[model samples]
Target: MTSRFPTRTSGPSSIASSIRRPAALGAAWAALSTFALSEPSFAQNAQPPVTELPEVTVTTTTTAKKKKAAKAAAPVAASQQAATPAASAPSAGAPAPGSRSGSLSVPTTAEATAEINRTPGAVEVVPGSAYQTSTPATTIKDALDYVPGVFVQPKWGDDSRLSIRGSGLSRNFHLRGVQLFMDGIPINTADGYGDFQEIDPTAYRYIEVFKGGNALRFGANSLGGAINFVMPTGYDSDLFGARIDVGSFGFRKAAVSSGGVSGAVDYFATVTAQETDGFRDHSDGESIRGSMNVGYRLSENVETRFYLNANNVDQRIPGSVTKSVALNSPETAAAGNLLNDYQRNIDTLRIANKTAIRIAPGTLVEVGAFNVDRHLMHPIFQWLDYRYDDYGAFARLSDESRIGGFANRLIAGVNLHNGNTDVRQYVNVRGQKGAQTVDAEDTSRNFSAYFENHFFVTPDVAVVAGTQFLHATRKREVEFGATPGETEFNLWSPKVGVLWDVTRNSQVFANVSRSAEVPSFGESVNVGPTVIPFYDIKAQRATTYEIGTRGANANFTWDLTAYRSEIKNELMCFYSAFGNCNVSNADRTVHQGLELGGGAAIAKGIIANGANPDTLWLHASYTFNDFFFDNDKDFGDNELPGAPRHYLRAELLYKHPSGVYFGPNIEWVPEAYYVDSANTLDTEAYAIWGAKIGFDNGGPITAYIEGRNLSDEAYIASASILDRANANSTLFEPGNGRAIYGGVQVKW
Candidate 1:
């Protein structure tokens, strides 16, 4: 893979960055640890001992009270276990029987547990806590601010490019390789590409990132893996609330939500609106989103839920900045930039449902399905006009149960999805633009079904196996630019793995899986006379292997993973000349890296000797990645571009039981290879630190202030070579010099 933008052909040189001290972080951790460890020994005690059930009557969501059967009428076997407190007693301040839990406060679901255990590959789940109090970013991409291993570059406020373990290369349009899902519904269009604008970060309950084979549960089409954004469920408890915020650079946002029970039913609804005047010229956008879920109880043994989500976004493109422009005026636009001269708008809608049934003792079955539709209108360089429409549907089924004797548990599931898409291109002669005329139209369909099962081979071990079958069909009205737009083929993907429980709180696992990615619209489109003619491109395939460990013990929790992937048909890009470049499938490539992450608590601030506050919190992650081509003829002995070699992020949080808090954070990137293939601009490594302080009234009203880039270091986020500069380049986007913003919130 090469730089997404055109850059000098010289090699890139990297200077190792120096390590710095975070004394504040160390102090915060020590404090938190001390507080947590010294807390009343009773707090660490397992669930309280239980005796016979009380005669108390539990009110159902429907306002219907069911009589508690006499102990003598209890079911035979598990009844004895019910008399004891659950291994994981509810946390302190837990919601009442059927009330909704706070957004980031909900407990993990069954699917989440399956992912935690059955994964034969590396995976990480960042709870909502990471986003609720941090950055003001509006998209899911923003939530990844300090996440390690993953690299997300926001083009503007609403659009971003994401790469994990170096999978989605040569992609300038939609996201490839990585599959995205929300509430079990596919977020990618019918053509298998995802856009960041479709996601509303504020609406999600939690995000799960499954890398390599661990994603087998979703399917093989996701060569880089899958990311699922879960939403609040009816079983959760909450009330209606709204938040409104305004900040620097014409940024504004508002969101509202309602969750509660009303008669044998639980429902949740959320709506949000946001707008921004981008840091660069012509970089402005506005968007609105809404999501809702309702649950119904049919009987003692059955429950069902319905979900709806939608988004509308409008924005102007602030094309890539030239190296010079990027460094000189990072927040300014180029004089006659074609890329940033266009306008684009997107609209999308989604609907889905899930049902769970308790078929027998310790056995349950679940089914889920959803549909998504999206439309995009894009203007190019103020000269070219384009339009696209996509629609897709997905369905899944699975069963969870514990078998006899062996003390074994099993989880098996299958998924089916299909999509259809249409695209058109036109030229706006002279100024007036409105999709002048249809230049191209194509429709594609993908049908796939996958199943995987987890078998507990022993009390301390488990094995997992799964496979996917995908058949695709494409029909194009015209073909001229790149590859044959019309095609058909069937592919099979398989995976297997094992996990060993090191202890009750920790486990280790490893697995190998196969994945494939088909071509995107731009990859097959024939554009003009100077551009190369189209040719059929095969699906990119890869074999990945990963191993990791995760554990949690009252005071400390950590997760780590190491992985490597060898790719065949890695699509790479090359610059030929002015306004000319080519995208060709490579023979082979490799990606390997390690991700270390964990968090710890140390001190007790205002809370009584470790009461209910996370007095001090610490979280950190480090990732090292290396990607290169394997004996390629065209591009020789050159490292893949874009990502830095080593990335590190750490945070130190301090809080007062009264709700006032302060946090200091840092992000470091080791100078690696530059964007260009030639080692020309040997980039230097750098580190940036930030601090945030806030006060909470304890009962709803809260205010906070933050300052980023406190170091005020000169750094570049993105750069590109100018067509007129020959070998010279300019920075397109400059990391903010220093920024300060603040906001307040109120809840009832």
Candidate 2:
């Protein structure tokens, strides 16, 4: 009745990645049994149109509404939205203001799923065709692995450690309480910290998640909330394209893209490059990225867009061991990190602009500005040189009429981030750079303003409200020591909610909120002989309670949620050193959760000749966490470590309608969780299985093959946190054992 992995340190060399796991599962079940005995051709598929619903609403017009709008067109998206199609009305070239689905500044994906179905709480819209036709999405946990209460892991190359709900359970590295965006600008760094390898998950085109406080349209007041990737415009991309990928430790990648539009202008662009040679040992990495955007049209109620981005990254650092050396040797390497050659490199550039107007016809307005230039050359344990100069601005206003006549909507926004940093330190000799110890300058400023409203009363109800107001600042200056000074904050956060619509594909919501976070600069750095230098910490607050339900028909679809939070001062770190980190504050805490995602269509004509027939799908997601501690005098109520109280993901598929799919997936963690807070170190609970085969017809051609951890399981995909530990804790990080991957894409 006692054994949470306590001995075993000699294993892990893995027969060269398990000998390509049976010729990649024998060519993925011989291409799924020769494509299930031939039968393909869907008359070049169709779908895409439906982005017009304003003029104070009221479009009905049915009588079979032009025969269900020519049987609902087609293209892009359908990897869940319960197989698309729903939420209608608005067609007839209806986009009289700077097109692109009636530009409210780029939306589409059915206006971002009708603004996350009028948000009340919890939101998500991941659909890059759900993992680009089947995984290996080069990180960000393969594009938010089924996003149910979001947790994300990957901790090497494309570095990750995302959190939402249990938001940053004790500072680990980089990232803290989420917030990152692109196309809505701001990519965290004005004291808030972020670097998820500058995100290039194949250059997005669908990704938005606004949890807690529903992120009030990006005026994000953390507690793990905002993420917006969205990119791909020239009206939804693909005028030209190319892709390539190969896998298993030594992975490779290549990419190209282009987009167009003439007269009134429009554009899109992309470029990528990659490298890998990791699976532990020094954990290799490399990257190159690019993106572009352009749009114009100054009449027809105005429009404007312009943006560019670039990045270069290189990483190497595979340190974190003990748990019996991460379950028996786990590719050893961690102890001065390869004799001090640990690394992290980056370079970046960004520029932005946005504009929109349409002051009437149900109103709209937008504005923007930005600038970023970063560079960091780290060699660990000090040999860090940094430089950053962030800047930002934004504005928004949206309105949908009918006040005394009921049905109303309004949104407001403003945000500005400011930054400056230029710090340097040396003395790592092996990774070069000897003498000099510290020199500094760090500054940050932030201002945010937000508002939201929806007033319906009935007609399927609505009553949601919002608020956010923050003003922050932090400063630092040093050359020798003692100057852990300057800090200020003015916070306010509020929210209220209610939304219903029970049928017509279900919905019901509830909310109660308030959240705030302030203290990034990795806890407002000090580096002196500290006895205190969290700059008087304080500003973590929370107050949440949520409820949820989502719907779909024609064989079912779902998304459920539940939440609870009650916190204060919760910014923890509990001690560390490999070059400082002691962080502070924690006097109460509690976070609760449950999320479920769905898809069914369990069976139907397994192969019934033509006209798109053949079905059988089941995709699932589940998450349940219960973070805690509320009664501390040095840890009393316990239970607050690093995630995993229970998590699950499931999949099963076989769908042919000529967009082939093949699946088998599972990732489970049944129990065992604790990484420290004196919960006394623990970890051991596992499940991993995978398979894939794909072909997507949203194109000129597409292909895929995948396999992972096919039972070569050695588990532990993440860990790193400490308050106390035993059995010589180095803090695990292993996972990724059996693998194979492949890809191809072309478009025109």
Candidate 3:
């Protein structure tokens, strides 16, 4: 099949008018699948968002000669990569280069950690080596369980309630505040809405969590920050690997991956498939995902990479139940869900390329573009079909040098993302389309330019400053029922901070930043009972003050941060008529919290009179949340719903030199917060226990056994939002019951 770019039309149109199609984003996808069967890597992306990537560089005349030279050296690079298995570590001086990302080669764990330490705010890097092979990391929740200040509650399947610093806490369903990325490319739609169903938690080398406005590097300007799920390259991954997992609730999963260098091209590919009957009725789901990346070296300082991704997801939503039903009969599905056979199904494909060039010493430039095509078939009270065509381009320049005899690091980037959606709605006849109800077209355009700089004031301290400019527009053309709606937003956010190097491995940092969120088409403007183009609704804005310290020494490592957000025109979801919701702006609110995480080795040598020395490790994460309205008209000083006031996750493990380990973990919520703006009702707090035993030798073979919620405690997992909730409100989602899972992996 041939892929074509979209052409601009003069006037508004309906869904039946015309639509675009894309394919051939598949041939390479097949290559990835085939490679996975022979050998595998864990860098997975949501069913590759079907996309077409346009080259973003100047073609050099020496391409032919460069290719030939690269081919000659490929064998040496491949052999060196093959020598290191999955569990090897890179040195701090010379980087163990993998594939190219941005204007530099992909770095190993140690290098990645060193790079992220430059951020003068709350940020962290979670290495895949820590969980990818040994844990059931099938979703984002599993990958981020240890990150402080971020809250992730699994709902069902790959869906979850995820938040950073109370972002999108009251606006339920699908991600709103956080920007999700795979290998530095955006997975969110043009309008900044996010979904995690396509993410394969097992397919990543590392995940970066940038809390609040620290995400300026990625052109992300939001209250919740950004998460970058980075896949490994040929040099960073095992030559080949495979794994399988099975557990209670009729759950099963299998994955395979491979990476190698042949000639000038180095590649990494992975595939995964899984299904489960689910712990609650009407919650069955299944998915298959694939990802691949190919790289070529035009020269030592200039290179380009190609990426392919695809996913197919089908999920049955159990729907929220009343609080009593959630705790008493947790397995029961809502009657309305069963009656309508509610479900969310999607198919996606994405193809893209990035080029990095070293223009001069200490100066690098990167440019890339991509296209995404996705289809969404959803059935609830009504049948909704949406076809998405999204494309974007990005460019960045980074330089490190001295100015006035002072060290300086400078970075700047710009991004443009635009898309159109073909929408058709029909009366639902139990999961099937009935008579057509409406046809429409939705278009979104977003553009952003950002820059951040660090200027060293002294040998041990630095000053940081940055700013971002954003422009967004939303247009909806309705063929029937409602009138057309078109709106636009523009914002400028600035940041300033200071960083003090307390030690070679530790730092103290603080920052003051501003952020803004423009509403998505999903949250259209409504006035009284009439739907219109717009009312007085405006973009959500916040000013945050943050301070923190993070570092490690000897056997102790810690990360702690505190922050407060004073918000204006906060966007919130309120109860609309007929079990629906609408977005509105609130007067004022305050959000303040503390995030703390630490790990230490308290003892050593417990086996056979210290004959075989071992270490006892304990890791803990704690969060304190205080979110409330600031003397509003309808709700006065009421706590905002959606999270617990106090949450903790802790684990204790015994480690040996041979990589064999065992650990017990706990998830605790001390008290429940309100579930509604009026504070009429709240959820119940509870604790769950789990354990893990694994042999992560990173040799020819490895295995693990895991158990979750072993006590089978009944509790609420997540809840919906409303203005004034009551006892009979169907807003609670029950937590999963006791379950056990085990998996074995082989690497070569």
Candidate 4:
């Protein structure tokens, strides 16, 4: 939270005096690593007739022990270009070629094999120059912690508790069965909970994870599916940016963005603010966000776009902490500030619009609309006193054609959600004198219809299908207890897949899908009316299967996947006393997993024998999940609580020569790994290694410094299950130790 460093140069034109040979600035940083593999638009707007794009500055050295590279000094002409806002365009990656109309800027493994060979469910995409030299994360679950079956646990620091595949296994707080979007609106909560501190994850430029039933193009009752966060448009980042970060417990962050064009219109906007002082005890929080996008150009085919997102947050709620206070001291804190000790505020809003048309010539058509609002302020414990307000609206239409020999595409959608909540209760004794209020009023009505298609059977092979039809209604009215209900459920989910391009790089895919879940409002009215009163529980079905393969050229690359799912009713969670909790429905369940990853550049004579074109990259992954529980008898074979069968990550990046850059990484998880659900004790397997260094001058300023866990390993990125009478050897969250940070960045 202290910036100021311009021993010369400040915007306009800089990058060390605009490339004055260093081999043309190493060919303009390899053309910015292929312009950060751009694709995934929506970044427009920035001053008069849209000029933006020209602002880059970063500085930090409040006692430099190590980490100095703030660069600055290079500004001499080309007044503004635009595009780099929207919270600094989440690290802008690029995408804007044919710009809209017939839009096609594929890549990200050909958009995950064209949505796994033509949609039908199950998808994945994580691109942004492949996490452009990571180590600059501000959520988005810490850059999806190395993707692969995603699992985010940020506890008190920035509040995140995501789960994919096993979607919010039983939830403790945020996220429930996936479903989160940005650009197409919807970020949960409107009765369909989801919260990762309104996600800022560095403002995103690419991140699409649809795991079951291909998320029916968004609006298919998530059973762990759907996640889209893309931003960065306007002819591939025009430019004008900003970024700043200060670390350790009392962290701080700031972001900015601005894009190009104006007149024919094209825009961008991004803003962010963050704060943290968490490590337990009275935590502390602060959040701010803003996003904007605009585009127009109604001729030559057609194009239209507009998107806006906003968020505000306030926090303070530590709670969970044990395991002998997390290994003798996981930063202790949380000893009853009781009565929920108040403090938790949030506000969110979203708006969207999209339009694309191209009468013929490859043919294409797209339409979209969106709206979402959420509000929450909760406080309670003695019994349960909550408050919430939700809202929703959505619409979509899609088409892509080629007729002639065969080539087609189509998608359709609709959604409208509503919400309500206001309840109170305080009196489990403890100086009880006055307390008792109610206002259940709940409603979650949904009507959905979806379809997808892709068939080219030849010319590289292709086959994909899709389906979805959901009509749901869940009403609750308590005015004051006693019989208040309304339940109506009707659902259908379908998906099929096939994709074999075996050549043109590589490919393979498979799919089978179905999912339905319904039951909230504290899982059907948290006890009362003498037990089981306001009923409406039915709709928890699942059946998923997946297969995968991936490939890339220019020196090797890879991706692999394998999955399985089977569920019925299943929605268990019964934890009595202390933080109580009870959500029924559990009869059968099974889920399998396997995901291998790849990345390579292993010296081709150090950049094809030309010496320092530098190059050497490697990436890795492994997941084996096995969750089980069939015909429950109070939790069977155990091992079904929060991911862990083996999760791994590895990295090594080095790109040097004048602009230098470094990397080293490893993250592991082992140990019996049972943090709850009657899984008596377990937790071991640990590994840690981290390193990063940076310096780039292609314009604006660039500098970096990082070191995490660097051997101080006392791992536990997530844990929960404290007190099973030392029998469970109690476990409580504990992660974060061994920190080192450095920052400096500026763009314009």
Candidate 5:
């Protein structure tokens, strides 16, 4: 297939108009050094003389009294044991004696990290506490800033583009390819579309990122794998907490939460409100979010839990502008956006339940069900109103035991998801509905079964294998059109890998896997002069080969991976003369990349040593993406449009024993990258500098001040629709200018 898109010739321009002053950098370093040397150490002050504090004395009890007390406590101990089932009990980070090797259980932070290191592919775990202090904590982008192989850039408010290993590079709207989950519950709709507005950064205890086929445990068969956000239960959370944040551009936020346990029941709840008058015109928004969960112990072998989530988001759209306008007049909004006051407003609610039962020693069974309702109101070139009802159910079984003196584990699961969308469109008369233009009903269904096993060849070596079978269907009933359309697809994906323990804290591994993605209803809709039904488009598929190593020690930690994928029938999109999008499939493409991330303590105990030593730390993440067409009929060996070839982020900070710290960071793109599939127009290479200072004593109070884009450089943060070069493309989203923000958090 050939596209009639026009091509153009252009050269890259300088992206950085200015750089940080030498005096500013010098002053920051000097201040950090001075504080590290002069501040009184909290560790020193925490020590006390043996005679300074009061002492308590215990009296010995008689044998007769002890016997009576023991008799009274026996029944209470038995009742406690009955209420806290082994299957639902809090994680202890280890299996019981004589238990099977495949038993499944929730893991604490330390245990989770260890498992991530042992996996045979790229993976990461981000602790929520790492960003809970002295940060804006506004969007998912903030939490994943330092993760390599991931590219996330904000459009306006909380809306952003998230790509993993070049996945979803052609998607200019909501997310695709990557699976999202909240507390093990699917966050994406039945057709695999997800939005960031429903995610609250403060609501998670930690996040697990499974890159590529490593996410087999969750039945995610997409190229980007999955990301799961884990929330804290009442047993692991604070009793009370509150936070307030204020910043540039009329930004303000407040949040409060409570968690507690009583008898056999535990509950956790949080509410947050936020608003911002964005940096550009027609870019203002507000949101309110609520999340809650309750858990009850049923018996010594079973437990159940329930969850609820609600969100109301109202955001104005700041449409993309021309490249020159984006660089020269960064704060200016697109004329169409200002005139029509384009906006995306949503109201959503979700409820879910999950149960766990221990059927036998070292064996567990889990089942869950969820329902979601959402309404959307949007206005741009047309007025759009959509309502969606989505629901799903899932079940999983796990067993861990020794087979013939060899440790082994097995995991199996099944998932079912279904949804229906009522879509309506009308002529836009200054952002108001004029006349009904189109009405349609879209339905989707998905069912999947997956199984994985890990067999230890030796104490230090393991072989892993998994497979998933998926059946999906999409149907669209055009009530206002002449014809309706429907499509069905079935696929089987398989994976195999090996892991070798090179040492106690390090491992080496390799894997090969296959992934497939079925097009959504939006991708099959007909528009413009092309009246051909998009149901003719085939699904995209890829086979990937990967290898990596990861490890952590007392002072240093690192993760690195390299992978290459050969893709067939890759989806590509471009603009038509009417400004509408036309989607098609490319014949062949190749995606390959290298991802690296690590951190180290450069200097320890500059002024003092021992427990609370003052240290200087350095952390860095880098990605090398090489994605292109492989001798295609139309665009032969052209580079992919969105991401750059090389991207790097690094930070250096000085810490004091008294919980004060200061840091400087940088986001650098050292090479210009193409913005069009024609390989004509491109983005300029640039570097940005930022700094932050904060005090966190691991106590009830924490505070911090942060600044970004300190040099006020103008650069493109992201882009829109893929197209051939046109002087009026309007495809650039400008990055925000210099700004400062501060916040405080308290808990008891």
Candidate 6:
């Protein structure tokens, strides 16, 4: 595949090529040595004993009480067994249920971490409580600030570019490549388009991240893998809670939540309202979001849950600016954005249900269904009005058994997703719809089936294999213009891996997998000159190889991974003079990276051992990215734009037994990175420093004050578009300036 646009022939001499083989080897050795030195203390601490934690009732209801009485009168042997304290404890390597104050429908944070560690692929779990205690929960970036290999930068309000392992690097608006889910229900549309506006970080109990093909179990077939946000249920949440936050740039937010359990039923709900007059021109916005769930315990071994989510978002767009302008007058809005009054407004509602049943000992069955409705009103180069209705269903079965003295596990599942969208475009009359230019109806249908098995070669070793078969179709009917089009795609993805336990809490793993992504309708919608049907565009595919190790003990924790992916038919886009993008496919490319995360307690017990607080602690996350196009027809071995080669975030903190803590943090980009595929434009390297002071005791009240960009550095946060950028290229998003924020929370 080749592009018609003019290209600049540049060799592999950019920032990505500066690292020679010797340097790579030296870095690898250094990382290995560091891991070795950090291993001893962690290994000395043993795993905690398995035991049942006490349960505390937070609320009661008459209807729930009657349901519990009816269930008690029924014959339920499985329920009886599950209720037994000794029988309820999870087996070794199994995820544990949440605490009594946690949701009964899902595993606790520690349990999720343990379960993720068992996978022979890259994955991580972040506890929600860690971010909600005393911090600004305004954006997804705030919650994932320390996750390695993930790049998150805000554009306006909740809209942001979220890329995992260089995934979705080219697309400048909305999200692709990465699949998003809430409690196992997909948040993305049936065709794999997603937005960050629907995610409520404060509503989740914990978040799970599966990188690359590790997310096959969830039917995610994309290079970026998937992220699942698990919400807390009534059985595991506080009865009442409230929070208020005020920050720089006219930011204000308030939220309230409640959760409780009564007899066999439980419920949890949260609502938040926020408004901000942003730091940059035409970047103001407001939003209101709510999330709720209710679960019923049919028996000790059977449970069902229902979820509801709603979001109303209105945000202005500042648009990108020239690099020179971004670094000089960072607050200036793009000229076109100001004239057109570009904006994005959306209203979304989602409903989902999931049920789990233990048909027999060590065997389980799960079924789920979801529906989503969304309306989008956007104005930029053109006025866009779109409506989407998406729905899907899934079923899964899993069994764990011992065969010939060896432990084995098998999982099989199927998913069906379908959606219809009404697409319309009109001339922009100062953000108002004018002369209609295009009208169409787009429909998508997707189906997938997968199976996986893990057989223990030894008590501490296992062999794993899995495969998924997918069939998808996209249909577009142009009601007011050119001919209609329909496209069909079929693919088979396979995976194989091995896991070896080095210690009770540590393991090493390796895996090879294949992933595929189909193009969404947005990719095929041509708007500028030379408009042509994109039915011939092919799906992007990649074969990835990965190796990693993860472990945690009382004093330290670490997760490190190295991966390389060879890709074909990569979905790529180039921008026109008017800022409109044309999507196409690249012949060949490579994405390789190293992800490292770790935390250690340098000093402890300064105040009292019984209180168990660290006097000094350090935590860090680092990513090294090397993404480049192979010898393509246009760009020869040039590095892909969007992400930097080396990025790091680190922090050091001091804690007192009295629940007071203070920390300093740094965000650094070590080298300039290209802003266009032609390698003609780049963003300068930068380092920013910040600090925070907070207090938390797992109690009723918590508070925090934070300062960001204390040095008031003017730097580029992100960029977009263009195949060949130059001095006049307007493709830079400026970083925020110095700011301070404070927040408080109360719970009962």
- Estimate, for each residue in 433-514, the C-alpha lDDT of model 1 and write its tens digit: 5343544566667777777766666755668787887787666665443233477768888888886655555556677788
What is candidate 3's lDDT per residue for 577-654, written digit by digit as tens? Answer: 444456677789877777878777777777622444566778788888878887888898888888788889888877
Residue 405's lDDT in candidate 5? 71
How does model 1 score by TM-score?
A: 0.81
Per-candidate TM-scores read: 0.81, 0.32, 0.86, 0.31, 0.85, 0.89
Q: Write the per-residue lDDT of candidate 2 for residues 1-748, one digit (tens) a residue.
A: 1211111112211101121122432343243232111222111001112234332212234522443343234432244332332322112222221224533467766567656667876787776667865665778788777778898878777887788888876767778888888887878888887888888988777788888778877766789889888787775666678789888888888888887555466678998888887888888777888988887766656778888988877777787787787777777778787787777777788889898887776577898898888887777776777778888888888777666767667888888989888887788766777777878788889988988887777655679888889999888888753354778899888899987655444555777888888877666333346455656787798888777766655665677776778888888766665423467778887877677777777886778545556677787778888777778888887888888877887778776666677878889988878888879888889898988877764546677798987877887878877767777777778787888898887766
Ranking by lDDT: 6, 3, 5, 2, 1, 4
lDDT (Cα, tens digit) per residue for candidate 4, span 1-748: 3221111112111012222112442342243233223333222111101111222222123312121222223221111100000111111232221123212221233233234333433355665434432355776655666667766766665676777767656766666778887755677755566777777766666677777667877755766788877776643442577778777777777788876554456666878888777655666677788887787756655667878877767676666555556655766655553333544456666777777665554344556666555555444344343444555555555555545646555566667666565555444332232366554667666667777676655654557777888787767777774357787778888877775544444455566778776666555425443254325455678887776655555555555565667788766665433544455566777766655555666653463345335566666666656676654677764556767777887777666444565778888775546666667665556788888777663445666788888777665667654213243233356777777766665765
95 Cα displacement, candidate 4 (Å): 34
RMSD of each: 10.1, 23.8, 12.4, 25.3, 12.7, 9.2
Q: How close is candidate 5 to the true structure, as a TM-score?
A: 0.85
Every candidate's lDDT: 0.59, 0.72, 0.74, 0.58, 0.72, 0.76
Sort the candidates on TM-score, descending order: 6, 3, 5, 1, 2, 4
Clash pairs (backbone) in predicted model 2: 46-73, 46-74, 47-73, 47-74, 47-75
- Estimate, for each residue in 511-553, the C-alpha lDDT of model 5 and write its tens digit: 8888887777656435556654657777888888877666655
Scored by TM-score, the top model is 6
Give lDDT: candidate 6, residue 476.
86
